[model samples]
Target: MEDDKHSLGLRVIHWLMAIFIIGMLCSGLYMKSLPLSNEIKFNIYAIHKACGITILGLIIVRIFFRVFTYVPPLPANFSRFVINISKAVHFGLYSLMVLMPLSGYVMSSASGKQIKYFFHIPLLINQNKDLANTANELHSMLAYFIVLFIILHMLGALKHTFIGKQNIFKRMI
Candidate 1:
């Protein structure tokens, strides 16, 4: 892989994850607004759940990949402020990516809902109503932070790519 961009494996995972996360976000929001007990709603909810579990697995792999790989350096003239924000945004994004799915799993399990991967493989985790309720609330609240961090991450990339003429996105492409 070129020093200007991410490795092919990372790029593939990054784009694949971007698409899946967007899909998961939209589906989750739609499902939350739908009336319960409807068939379509149920199906969409199931899909969302499956995707969440899949993302959890993928994120685990991604974390390992990230830990073992080297990222391209920032531009020589980049300010400390920019570099600090970059670190924070990336840290926030990774934290949310890992926590979001775990929280959802806890929420589902606590509610005594079986987690199925693609509606096939069963995920057997502990169940507790109180725990589920707590995780459910936390998951809902944590989503705001995730959205905020994602927007910040994108904005930083755009700033570097367009304004700074750094083409930082090339590293991720």
Candidate 2:
């Protein structure tokens, strides 16, 4: 059981990233649907940007931990195809984890909005209308892909936990 589990640091970071990512996705959608003149909408935007930057920092730490830690292997019973799919899903998730926040930062920075880490420290970045638009478009498009990948990841974990009786979820726990 011990051998099958991820390191404590990894598990904690994984869950933290998951929570932030899910929150960001939902808040982002909600903010977009809100009226431009809404005061609460701007507040949500500030919080969203702050959380996005936090996610970016967490992701960097997550990557560093992932590199230096021992990652538990998947169940031995999983077939080659299943393993391949799992790898692909993880790759996609990791990529999006980095890209999503980065795109958001670029969008905010280019739009001439000063980004504050947790609503305090300022991050210096130049504004460019064209770049802002481009980043916004990319960030918007990436949202769908991130959602899809997250669903796939959850489904795969569910399959292993219930159908396969592998109890793979224990690893993260």
Candidate 3:
């Protein structure tokens, strides 16, 4: 059986994650591009860290929701190859959604930077520069892949809506 749209919980999580991830990406790019003072940059980094932590929590909840919820099947006309590709894209997105925040948290914690939830809760761990550098490199590398996958995902949705007239985008709405 298939439904025309996603559940309310799924839609809520999707939009919330989209907003948070976009904000984190824009802030990260801007922070890297300018010659900002160390203090200012540090402040921005703190905000990013807080957002990342929140995203991490959301992703955890999303995982549970995904396991418990029923996902609609693709249109019957969709070929096996198309279904496989769709699965791959969804898997990639979910993987990055979890990894991106996790890698950031590791980088921050290992680099001796404090990671607090809204500047109130303490989330400190033992410092390890080597681990920090590794996590940072992984996070940096994955960012490009994430962006690429996101664009591809969006294009697929647009194609379904405009070219195929499949109404696939409505499933997520």
Assess each prediction's global lDDT (C-alpha) against the native: 0.82, 0.89, 0.84
Q: With candidate 3 superimposed using the best TM-score fit, by how many Å does residue 45's alpha carbon deviate from the native?
A: 0.6
- Model 3 regions lying over 4 Å from their true place: 36-38, 118-125
RMSD of candidates 1 onward, in order: 1.8, 1.5, 2.0
Candidate 3 lDDT, 1-173, residue by residue in tens: 14666677888998899899889888888778767656788788879888988988998988888788876778898889888988899899999989998899888888877786856535365789999999999998888888888898899889888998997888887
Q: What TM-score goes with each of the models? A: 0.92, 0.94, 0.92
Looking at candidate 3, the ten consecutive residues that score lowest on lDDT are: 116-125
Model 2: lDDT of residue 41: 92
Better of 1 and 2 by TM-score: 2
CA displacement after TM-score superposition, residue 2 of candidate 3 (Å): 9.2
Clashing residue pairs in all predictions, respectively, total 2, 0, 0
Best by lDDT: 2
At residue 129, candidate 1 shows an lDDT of: 80
Best by TM-score: 2
For residue 33, model 1's alpha carbon misses the true position, in angstroms, by: 0.7
